[model samples]
Target: MLGKTVKVVAKPRRGTRGAVSPRAARMVLAGAVLAGAVAGCGDEPIKMGAAAVVGDDRITTAKVDRAVLDCEKQFKADQVANQVRTALENQRQQQPTSGEPADCSARSAIDTMLNIEVAAAAAKAAGVSVSESQVDRMIGLMSQQAPAESIVVALGMPKQFTRDVARMNATQGLILQRLGADGNAQSPATLQAQQQALALFRQTAGKLDIKINPRFGSFDANRMTVTPITTRLSATESGVR
Candidate 1:
């Protein structure tokens, strides 16, 4: 989950394991911050490791650790109260009991983070960079999309929402701005911006090195380890429904 930079867990490059290089962590974090700030909600508290490589860059374990922490924090801060209320409604029904179930929304956040990381790496390789003006433009767009009051209530803090959103918008803006200037698109000046975005979207995606781990679900970029759990009911417990 992307959020404010609380702390970074940086590790050196290793040969045996697929952990990320420290430099890549910095770049990925910068991009992730721009893409999706963590909202912190989940149950079962799944732990994951990042070892996927993007060309020469690695997506270190530290990044995964940080993401989990941020996700947990956001879960408590934003979703826990609402979830508690919902759970109460289902209390009367016989329900399966478990820790926290996997969060599809959080999974989407991880996907966004990976995309930003890979895109930032590709942009760097292409010698593209972002400008302050570009960041401002992104912030402007976010301000329009997420009104100050809604964000404040969503995040539980007015300043936190504004400041974090500003950072996310600015960083993402830089990426889009650079993509526009790289001549990735062929169009008249009026439509060049849209074309550039499309070109970048198509061109930069396949560049990353991803390995999926089946334990986590359908998409696994790092090939992290997993152990399946199974429980079978006895004949009496399994009486015809």
Candidate 2:
């Protein structure tokens, strides 16, 4: 059984117009890419100590742990330095008192990496690509709202993976553009386009072999998120027939 589930969606802040802000749009697109049940069983076994496997690539447990630690450290430092509070103030948003759970951080790291892989695959299939310059430009635009490091921490991402986050966002943006989002998130046409893009990503994700280690939790393909697995007693352990 699944325990606590960590779903990562960029909640809209105050003063944002449309159904989704640009930042929120990026997160939503990545998070909602695959909407269905858990990933189907695959023939190839998951590598030992892997956090998750996407096709030929392996997201190692060590990598996840390091990311989580880095995020926590950076967040703590930000709190001490008042960077988070200042950023929230600049953005006219209320501040959060506590950091997210360790499990959630791990899930986030896994999900972000998985989303990047899926986005790349989707782009390749669609004959679309986001250039490095485009990613840099997107990061620059994001930095206009707040410092990149602060934004990274605010998004629950590690500072080290800043470029990865921006690249994923840029790729999704290009995909949505190709799907005719038109920069009007609140418009029906844009919403329809987003839906179409999401469906395309879902199809792309289905064709890839994805697996999550049970220790971290199962991958919920429906939500494109990770859900914690609850330990269950066997029939003999429970004294049942």
Candidate 3:
């Protein structure tokens, strides 16, 4: 699946009163977007300098590291495949280059990993819980959606990547589900909860003196410039890549 592209438009501050700090808003939103990507719940631990305790569960560096790796592998393989395909398409006119592609997969994966950790923490604080079966289904769907070429190799996928991804998906779905239930498409409670959660995220982010690492993604306006955040897409549907 292709990655989603998110467009973030920063409104310029007029006078001092009109000037709300875009930096803080951007940082908080960036955190939220990143959390959204990794909220795919799984039992696997995400690598942490210190084990991040969420309720009774402890997220390990190994589990999150693996998940990040899987995504990285897939993304890099896809990039390579795209390059090859482009070269092959022009092969009749020119020869293809014989050089290895830069590995940015790990960076992307790490971003996802960090986002998930933050989001999971928020979830725990909000008292969100998901079922194992729900997690299973999400994993199955992601596995089915994986690119065909990368499916064959051992590209960073553990035996349990599928299950872990599923758990993450389930967790994300639960959060979204709580925000919107039934086919009506609008729930006052869900909206209120979303607002509350967003506020909580802002408050939490305010407390952490964050330092942005630029090696991950580009931090263009309206896009995820950091690792934990993925680009938001224009599609009305949920789940980008």
Candidate 4:
């Protein structure tokens, strides 16, 4: 999510594992300040080791590497050429632009993973649940729209990561279902539940003490997504619904 930045970022480069290298992390101006600046609402920042730490869970660099390899398996350079262009164009329109996008990269895949992890954590906190069967059913429904792998790639995620993300989405849906929000586009109950879920998400984020590698980016509280800390951004409290 694009939001206010304390400083604008310079151009971006792709990291081998779908993030900027630590060396590049150092190159980015104001890297140290942004590292743990927005890790928690007021709690102590998480110490970096793996890619990030969400609550008691650790999202490791090894997982990220596996995802990078999965993304490579999903599509070839020519297949996603136009889509990559469009994605970059979208990133280009950011308010305090976070620099250029990688030409032939799976970097954005990491963002999808980060968002899913945060959303899953929040959903668990909100008492949202989806059985494995429910997840499978949702997967079937979504696959009817397109191949599962293709859909994941379309969302800038690794094909191998689809099942978990699908489960997360299903859990989010369960929240709406519990509120009787499903099939009621403009229901007050739906809106209230959505609001409540967001609140829970923010609360969870506050206590999660998430620490992302400065290489990939800093978390944008407003959008609940990671933004490259190429600049000194003014991050605020936020969550992913």
TM-scores, all models, native as reference = 0.39, 0.71, 0.42, 0.62
Residue range 53-152, candidate 4, lDDT tens digits:
6667766667777777666656554233224334434545753335434321323555555456656776677677678898788677655423444445
> In terms of TM-score, which candidate is strongest?
2
Candidate 4: worst 10 consecutive residues by lDDT?
Answer: 26-35
Mind giving the per-residue lDDT tens digits that candidate 1 earns over 32-132? 33221111111222223433334445445455445555544554554322232233223213233211223313233344445555445545655666565
lDDT of 3 at 189: 56
lDDT of 3 by residue, 1-241 (tens): 0111222232322322222132222211222233322222222333333223333444444544565565555645443223322332333134223211222244433444444545555567657776777665554443342322322112223233444434544554466556553322245655555555555544443343222222223233233223233546431222211
Model 2 per-residue lDDT at 160: 71
lDDT for model 4: 0.49
Between candidates 2 and 3, name the one with more favorable TM-score: 2
Q: Can you give the lDDT of residue 200 in candidate 1?
A: 50
Per-residue lDDT value at 3 in model 2: 11
Ranking of predictions according to TM-score:
2, 4, 3, 1
* Native-referenced Cα lDDT, model 1: 0.35
| Candidate 3 to truth, TM | 0.42
Candidate number with the higher TM-score (3 or 4): 4
Task: By lDDT, rank the candidates, best first.
Answer: 2, 4, 3, 1
Q: Is candidate 2 or candidate 4 better by lDDT?
A: 2
User: What local lDDT does model 3 show for residue 167?
Assistant: 50
TM-score of 4: 0.62
